[model samples]
Target chain A: MTAARAQEPVIVVDGVSKFYGDVLGVSDVSLRLGRGVTGLVGPNGSGKTTLMNLLAGLIRPDEGRITVLGLSPDQPERLMRRLGYCTQVDAFPAGSTGRGFVVHWLVASGVAPRQARRLADRAIARVGLLDDADRRIAGYSKGMRQRIKLAQAIAHEPDVLILDEPLGGLDPLARAEVIGVFRDLAADGCTLLVSSHILHEVDLVADTVVLMNEGYVVAEGSVRSVRAELTTHPLQVLVRCSHAGRVASQLVARDDVVELRMHADRGGFVVSSRDADRLHLDLERIMLEQGATVETIVPADEDIQAIYDYLVSGAGGS
Target chain B: MSDGRGPLLPAPSLRLRLAQAAAIARLELRHVLLSRRAASVSLLAALPLVPWVLAAIYGTPGRASLGEDLVGFSHFVDGAVLRLFLLLGCMLAFAGLVRREIENRTLHYAFLIPVRREVTMAGRWAASAAAVATIFSSSTVLALALACLPHGRPAVTAHFLHGPGLAQAAGFVAVIVLATATWGAVFLALGLLARRPVGWGLLVFVLELLRPMLPLALKRLTISWWLTGFLPLRSQVKAVVGIPAPPPSPLAAAIVLGAVLAVAALVVAWRVRRLELAYSGG
Candidate 1:
């Protein structure tokens, strides 16, 4: 984590709840986000977009309060100057060029036209869309549209950016380039709340994550910390060694190991342990004692996919 | 996130607010004046020019004198240009300002800016009013020139230079401007408040059309009655309609129209301030 993530919160949501008639949007969603990239991960209809909308002042919270950069969303004159939102809606004004889209929004935010143009060009370049910046947005591809939206959101140099599914339609190379941009921005102390369905990408880009399910945040904090707190589910590790039988025998007898199963080919074994640190130490000691040539020792259930499967999908629930 | 540097920018001044509004107006003006909707408004505005152009080419049916032609032109302006074409044109222009954006899911762009929503609404209203007024006012002028064309060059010059022709043209332009400004505000507010602003705009048009037959007190409430106070041929209008009451003084009419404009602007501001982004059925 960067030092920027250790600073005071830039966005504070206190027991916020929203409802759309009989439907629940988000319920009791409270979060404190510092300066850095925070992935907002949830399945569809999990209220991730709703929470972002509330922060962006697209909708008012029905039951609680939120503040971004110490200003209420209702105070848009002050809040919008510091906050930027790249909404998931993939629509633009008809007949607008990509550069015109960014520059017009900047000018709307009180930036002078010349400065807006310069800043728009800079931002468009940052998103790697300088070549297509002058093309009409209606002719842009889906990924190009997403990049232009990102360009407009960052054109004003806002302190906080709330991006809903910002990386949805991107190809692999563009996704990596966009992830690099996020990293660069986070390193410069900009706070970003990014929501995406690509869980592994979220794991790659975010320093912390807020996981939601059914309109409620089920877990939050750094991925490792949240994984550590899930004591009900044991951590799984895949061990590959020359002497799998010997290593399995040694690990199965350990107090930390709860379950063990040998691989079908008998070249390795999967071990479930209550304590990952202890399991790693035990594997190292056993491998040395048995003269086992261990080729790979991988944590099988510590990533975001496992966490999402365990918490959101209720897979193998104990 | 602020780096302990406090705000990177100061609170926007009133001048900045006005500049933001002007920027929005410039963008919206381009759309209103160039979009397919603009073409429709142009067609509506040009409707009055057709008969006048034909008269200049083929002459009037009875070979009417200049005085009679002027009287006929006055009626045409009051009835076709002002009552029918201007009303429909403003409806098409102003009511589409917010409604079209909402339908297109583009209103959030303006809402996300660091300016008040009222400023956004005002900017859009100003653009619509300017576009409608420019198109219809230019049409009115061309129609007047064509109506006066077949009366011979010397007589037409004397009528325009020394007679009431200049004042009449100016009155038509003033009425167009004032009517567009006031009606544009009302339609803008309706666009925010109503799900179907065209229906509401047509209802308003119906009320405006019925103003001549209403009681004096009720007539005073209609935009048409107040606009009539500026008509150069008020006596000709009165002679035909035979209404007993005198029209409101020009100053009183101006004040009433100004008051209506202010009220409509306030409604627009209030409605837009409370607006939430609900674009599902837009």
Candidate 2:
């Protein structure tokens, strides 16, 4: 790696494709992930979980190779030693307490019995499940089960962490706490790859994003850079003002504005702009000069769904 | 690339690998024991003993023919019913040993831990074998004691030591253990190689069942062919099937079982190395 790229990518997928027979798990997918929290945002069955499985060595890609921290995906004994994966699946082996589940996994990882218990305790405490550590996992609530899974993954403090839809089961408070845990791990220089269906959740903690649709990575980079490439797609901004009619007339006069649509029953109008930043400044100028009283201005179409739609529009075609 | 975490777990070694496998066996033992998967077979194992216990305790008219009853019980029930019962029971437990975890979506946790896949497979096999043997072996001993106890303690003692009685009992135990171990390896390998092992189980059953009908040269291939030689009393049913040439000597029978064990170990070791965890793959 060049000095400019000093922190080498921890995971690399080179022209990889996985197929369950004819159905594509992922097609010619390639990615390079560095040391930080990276979010994988995609709709259901868009190959997010499939890609995680490939990295975790739970499945092999039929076509191309995968490397995790300079180790092959086939080498679980080596790859898993430096990595921890938290899956969305909540089913644990029956008849095990939270403590047993975490500690036994640590023991299986070659930690001595006494130390495994101590580490399991710390990990459980970190996820705030210490009180319920003695209870069977099957009896845990959905959010509690989510925390315990996180607890097991972080117990060993592996350098590379992969989580698949980990936050879907959490309440707002637990979600915030788990996100805090991710931040702390990343702050400690751990590489985190987190997948989620919600865009804003990824937007919260991810330093970069890998967006996918229909088994292909639609876009990947810093959220700002990825959003910048959607230049041709109409950026919809919701403008709420007292005199919507007057504001729309002035906003349309600008070259950046593509079109305008009025809200059904409000003092607001949706402005389609080629450049949202220029349109924002122009809207302000138009509002001040027109003496319009505006309630709120929000970017309505800047989320992941809009980006995915623009990139993979014809993917479902036969 | 370091995360600046504390010291890592021990480096992989044979000692640690076996230690990890033993720990996994300990963890899995409780779970397998409490599962309902073995319920039907367990009930079947104990059911045959219930009649003998009732007969032994009460003054049943069949008590006068105690020696014949014991022999019949040893050959027919021990060799046939309980042997098949352990085969099916152990098959159920060991076949799904790895696959059930994959099916339940819990197998990834084993893979997620920094351990060799072989360790987990060995641990699961050990734990399943331990649980199956505990339940089935007890039933075997109970059924034999029930038949022999009412014949009078002194007579039973004399009968057990002097005659083939002791060797016969030992053989039954040996057969149960070897059969469970051998088939456990087979089905565990099948479980690892494919998603649904029921089809493989059926194929093995047909092949073993046809072992007798084939010529003597082919007979050596069946596990039962070697195992049947160790029985203390000759099997009446085998007389009809034809002993072919006289059954191989006891040492040869054991050597054949050892070969089966070695083959089983190789299959398990080979399959687990490439065993990928995918629920849909099964």
Candidate 3:
């Protein structure tokens, strides 16, 4: 496929710092983006939502500059029209049918009356809520309510979409469907910024990742690049054999095996080394030389979850 | 090229601002029109006027002095209905305008939109004004129609559009509209600025009620003081009450009310422009 359009930055933040009284909301955060999907990942209270609000023009940073679609968050009118923000707090006006509510929202956004209705229908259909479009919002389930919120956000076809915890309350099936919608929207070239504590979801949907912790952007880049920045620890080895005691002694004697734990179930012996491949080779030779039956050899750091934990907690670096 | 002046243009126009305002208004209307709470409030508002109608029908028509007294009673009843309905309408409408959004957590939903905060505030005030008028008008008409029976006074229907009464009632309606709109605006700012608005709104109500009893010019500082000054009954009771009289001209009173509204609107806009959602230690 031809390269997707590379326009000027639709959003830019420079040295943006926010504080609530004395507590830092997010400090000295800077980012520039034009399009495509970017995942904002962090534990709760890590300021992912705050940064989303800042981008949506819902809130202003006290100490820095932010421009969304070349409009200041402080001046929400011009910017709001060009962006669609699906807030974590999903709500609809009481007593209104999903169809009526969505259409009215588009009308309020300055869509022509007739066009508003059409667009509302189209958006509801897009979110797979076409069958239930005419039902009162009060009668809808939580997952359906979230879809209505999504429908309103996209009804006007805003240039940018900011979704904060969009998948928080969905069931597994609903999550898969919503994730498909997000991926499709991103693939269509909408500048999508999603914040979720669910790491696997972010890894699946985002090409770029911004990791925050304690009101700071600790890491931001391509997912692979940022994960690689983690301090690589020695690989772990677990061995279960007839001569386990002898294997443990041999592993500890090696300079690379820094930490060792021996299980009492006779299941195996666990050992950590700086070079996992080297340890694998050494263990192979030792097992052959000692004639010990080996059961399992696994590198503990091979999973993304482990990499995420290591990056977030500064486990090795700090 | 043209005397060093650029083409004369309306500065950026209020198109976007107006659009934002309309969206907010539409949201409020959708909320009030569709919600059960609004229906319940409408029922509660009409409930008080029911007793008056029953009293007018079944109470003592055979007494000698009853005819004259009934005539006088009719006028008094109409005026009281107008006054009471407007006052209650304002209190109830503004209370809901500020309180319900917070309770539902829907106010934060609006903030997520790219609309200007001030536009949202003002639009809510506008929508609430429209909704309150619809509720109060129905009550006033019902009360007036009941009051017009037996006296052959042609009822309260035609009277609404007549000579001095029309201008006076219009003025009354205008004051009610402005007072409630201003009240909603101020409370909306409080709602957006603070985590809790109902507590603050009630405190403001108490402050306004005690304003006239204060020792200084602080009476002018209260919204109720200006609102009551515009009440036709205040002019009637001025001599006997011995209250510190407001300026003599009704026009001056109107201007002061207008000023209060303008200032409150500006404050709401300013507060909304700077609003920062700061729940998580930010």
Candidate 3 collision pairs = A19-B282, A20-B282, A234-A273
DockQ for all models: 0.49, 0.37, 0.21
Clashes in model 1: which pairs? none
lDDT of 3 at A129: 94
Best by TM-score: 1
C-alpha positional error of residue B34 in candidate 3 after TM-score superposition, expressed in Å? 4.1
User: Sort by DockQ, best first: what order?
Assistant: 1, 2, 3
Candidate models: Cα lDDT each: 0.85, 0.78, 0.67
> TM-score of every model?
0.94, 0.84, 0.75
Of 1 and 2, the candidate ahead on TM-score is 1
- For model 2 the TM-score comes to 0.84
lDDT of 3 at A29: 94
| Docking quality level of the chain pair in candidate 1 | medium
Q: Residue by residue across B1-282, what tens digits does model 3's lDDT show? A: 011222111122479568658767877776776666467647755865686588568745434232343344333422343334444455566655644665665665566555556666778788877776666555654554454443335433345445234454454455555565666666656655666656776677656655545533775666655665555434443322224555335666578767867876776777666655543222
Specify the highest-DockQ model's number. 1
Q: After superposition, how far is residue B256 of candidate 2 from its true place, in Å?
A: 2.7
Ranking by lDDT: 1, 2, 3
